[model samples]
Target: MNKILIVDDEPNICNGCKLILIEEGYDVDTAMNGSEALEKLFEQNYDLVLLDIRLPDISGIDILKQINEKRLDCFVIIMTGHGTVENAVDAMKNGAFDYITKPFDDKEIIKATAKALENRTLARENKMLKKQLYDRFSFDNIVGENHQIKEIFDKIQRVAALDSTVLLDGESGTGKELFANAIHAHSKRAGNRFLAMDCNTFSPALMENELFGHVKGAFTGADKTRPGIFEIASEGTLFLDEIANMDMNIQSKLLRVLENGEFKAIGSGKVQKTRARIIVATNMDLKKRVAEKKFRQDLFYRLNVFPIYIPPLRARKDDIPKLAYHFLKRFSRETGKQISGFSDDALEMMVNFEWPGNVRQLKNVVERLVIMSDTHQLSRGFLSDHLEIKRKGGVPDIQTPKTLDELKAAKKKFLTVYFGKIEAAFLSQAISRADGNITLAAKNAGMQRSNFSAMMKKHGIVADKSSD
Candidate 1:
């Protein structure tokens, strides 16, 4: 049940409001003056407070100030006999939810109470959601026990407390965003917004507008004034992914913001200041980009204040089983599957195979395995045919020969005929799975299209015309 407090000097008004609110299923309390109201508020939390502007001992506006000073999370409605527009405006500016006159109707009072309680509930729910988000991205939630990962964790603990510009350098699919979120969650600004933008996803003009915003008459299609990421993320954190792909002109503007803490809207003359902490990520070598004159050297230096390098999945092979099982459990819960675990052979193959797509590719493969398997245990047979083929280095189901002579003869014979056949079959399956698209086939096989096609030609295989 919602709790409500009615504060008024008039005994009749206090009793009437208490009775009405109680009948409406609220636990209501009455305070005869501002002093009593403050005492009650400090004792317990209430969902809504009906405050009177005129009190014998103290003014209600002062009580409002006290509530704010104490950081009380309750809705306030001003009830006043002197219902001047100036008084109502002042009350609202001081955090009053609504203002009611002396001759207020009973229905109006009930309506205001209900609306205030509703808003209170919404605020509580938002707080809970933010807490959940913070917990989800906390450093402890990052799954890895490797030494390199532990070092990164320690670095995050030290870096998060400071308000420095962070540059994350890593390969594609190395989970740079995950590290970024962990940083923000552990930072002093965790309660504020964490906005992420991909530099490679937008064109130069659109990216500029997204970062710096625009005025009403800024461009042909701009209908009204809009705040950019910098404004929206004020006193928070802004994550820029693929930062090397940003245009050089925009890089200069971003550098200016970093240097002066101020920026102008696209078509506005007014300057605005922002206190957003910037964290940028890139897969490319930024130093190389600067040397080639593709990226601004000054801007790169500005962003590289505190650099963090995330190693790829191949480099962190020890974390493969942990990550694989982590993804398995997640996908199993999501898809309503009851997969127990992977077989020893399956786990070995996964650990041995090179994941060119890194952790992202491993996650995709795990999800696919979970969706396709019917048995509780994931075995080598359940693994992707390409991965199995890569592991065996030839066709699967080959039996070992009894003697060295037999082994040598079988190996030669297998090499003469089975090699070309198995290679062709593998290429055919990849292309067919990709709907005869060579580019996609090569990508799935973790090979360049030219290399995949050359192997295909060597095996006397040709792509279908429909593939074009």
Candidate 2:
């Protein structure tokens, strides 16, 4: 329940306000003077305080000052009589939430009290939300120990303090968005908005409208004027992902903003300005796109001011174990599982295999592992199913197949090599399990010793010649 303190020198007014608030489902207290109000405020926490500007002993403004100095979690509404309205305004400037004039009725008092308490609730929610964002996106939460990763981390720390444009280039799933978020969180604009948009998610026209909002009647569905992210973000940060896919026309407009920090809403002649920092990301080379005339050279140059290249997972194999365990710990707690750790073989599989999708892919695989686990440890079997499928994925960067015969032949060749690898690994593990005895391995696999020996020889795997 919201508790309110009514502080007034007049006994009738203070007690009457207390009764009114209590009847409205609030826990109300009455203070006959400034000293009494300060005493109660220090002894307990109240949601709202109704204080008179003129008190016999200490002034209401003095009590308000003490509350502000103590940083007490309460809202104050100054109560002033006819000639003391100016004093009430001065009291408000000293930290009172609002002021109610004298000769106020029940309706006026209730409205003021409700408005102050509502603002208090909203302020607390906003504070909690900001804390959550800071905790989740802080640089400390990013798991990486590789040299390239360390360098990138150091680079971000330096650039995050600047207002210059940043360009992040990496593979599709290398976590460019995560880096963008970290940059915004560490920047001077951290207290403001951090808005993001995927350039590839919208067409040229829609993308322009989203970046620079439109005036009413600017489009078919226009009902009222709207502020775009550039306006909404104001002096904060704007992260643009997949920027390479942006249309040429939109790129020109973006270049103007980078050049002069000014933009015009669609269908409006008035020019508006923004100081929002730009951070663009892409999985492709913007320089190459500029050469190909698919992207604007001027805009590409502007965006490439501070480039941060994120290394792919294959280039940072050493960090795979740590990244995997990081995801493991996260997913374990989320899924309510007690997964202790991964097996050595499983770790080897994770490190040796190439993650084309990069860190995002590794995180997803760990999530699945957590779901499939029944024991405290994640075994190699759980990983083999996922990695084997990944290993067989993707084709070589050869010419595109045209004829049906060529497509069929390509498929056949791929499956043949794929099965060969699977067979070799299977045979090697079976031999080791059988203590290098081909006879026992053949018996276990329900195959003849001669057939097993022939298979091992064809695969160039030496057999137990002395045994079977």
Candidate 3:
């Protein structure tokens, strides 16, 4: 049951509200003055407080102030007489939920109480969700002990509090967005939305509309006015992924927003302001793109205000086992599987293989192995065939090879065949996992579709009807 405290100097009014709320299934308490109400609040928690503007001992507005200052988890509804409605409105500005006049209707009071309770419930849920998000993205959750990764963590700690434009530079699947989320979660804007958009996913016009919103009739099929990510993410953080793919015109507009903190919606001449913190991530070298005139130099410098470079999985091989087991545990719980762990040989194979797709590839591989394994522990047999092939095609034993030239020839032959086989297996797995959808396979492998198709063709793997 919901708890409510009714504070009014009039005995009849207090008794009437208490009886009505009690009948509506509330644990209602009545107080004749602000002092009694404050005393009751200090003693126990209440979900709603019906406070009167005119009290004999103390004003109800002062009680409202105390409630806010104490950070009490309760909604205050100001009760006002006919001429005192202005004071009740002022009380609302000071954090009162809604004002009820002296001749309060039973239905009006009940409706206001219901809405306030609903808002209170929503507020509690939002707080819980924010806590969960913060916990999930906390520094403790980032699974890496490498020096470079530790440096990144330190950087995140130092920069998270500052409202600066951050540029995350790294290869795809290096968890740039994860770091971005961590930064936002640790910032003052944690309670607000942490909106993200992939720059490469939309065309120039659509991207413009997505970031800057549009008025109704702005373009074809724009039937309704829409608030863009920038507008919606106001007072929060906006993460732009694959930012190097943003068009030059859009880049110019974005630079203006960063510089002036203002943007005009599409088809609207009126300029609106935004305070959304911009954090951008790019897998490509942005400086190179700027040099090539593909990306704006000004925008590049603007976003580079606070640069954080995340090291790829290959550079931080020591973190592989930890990250692998982390994913294993996560996927196991998610899939309700009880696979214990990986065998030494299986782990060694994973560590030795060049993870071209980086952390994402490793995670996908682990989830696959966990799903496929029916045993207590993962063994080398559970490892990808590519790893086994590479292991078997090792350097030839040259104990009897007397000539240096002959040994060099044997090494070269082994490398050529070994690399060819690895390439074939890698491409085939990517294609097969994508169900022959070349575009999706290329994206998963973090390669251009054309390049992926070329590699597939080099290995004599033809695209089937499923390629569509």
- Per-candidate local distance difference test: 0.84, 0.83, 0.85
Better of 2 and 3 by lDDT: 3
Instruction: Indicate the residue-level lDDT of 52 in model 3.
Output: 91
For model 3, the stretches where C-alpha displacement exceeds 4 angstroms are 33-39, 53-66, 80-95, 98-108, 215-220, 223-227, 384-468
Question: Candidate 1 has what TM-score?
Answer: 0.69
RMSD of 1: 8.6
Clashes of 3: 0
- Model 2's alpha-carbon lDDT is 0.83
**Most TM-score-accurate candidate:** 3
Q: Kindly report which residue stretches of model 2 are placed more than 4 angstroms away from their true locations once superposed.
A: 82-84, 145-164, 186-193, 213-228, 231-236, 265-277, 287-294, 304-307, 315-318, 333-338, 371-376, 388-468
Model 2: which ten-residue window has the lowest total lDDT?
Answer: 459-468
Tens-place lDDT per residue, model 2, 1-468, is 999999999988988898888888999999998888899999999999999888999998889999999999999999988798888878878888999887889999889999999999998886776677777877678888889988988998999999989999886678888888888877777778898898766768889999999999987888899988899998899999888778888889999999998999998999999999999888767788888898998898899899999998899999999999999999999999999999999899899988755777788778888998899988887786555444335432234679998888777655645676678678877866774455678788888978887886544454322210
For candidate 1, which ten residues in a row score worst on lDDT?
459-468
Better of 1 and 2 by TM-score: 2
Alpha-carbon TM-score of each model against the true structure: 0.69, 0.73, 0.78
Over the stretch 1-468, how does candidate 1's per-residue lDDT look in tens digits?
Answer: 999999999999999999888999999999999889999999999889999988999898999999989999899999977646577679899899898888777899999899988888888886776687679987667888889989998889999989999999887677889999889888888878999998866778989899989999898988999999999999999999888878889999999999988998899999999999999998778999899898999999999999999988889899999999999999999999999999999999898877755777788788888888899999986784434244255554547889999899778756745675677789889977874456678999999978997886554354431110
lDDT tens digits by residue: candidate 3, 270-346: 99999999999887677888888889988888999999999888999999999999999999999999988989998
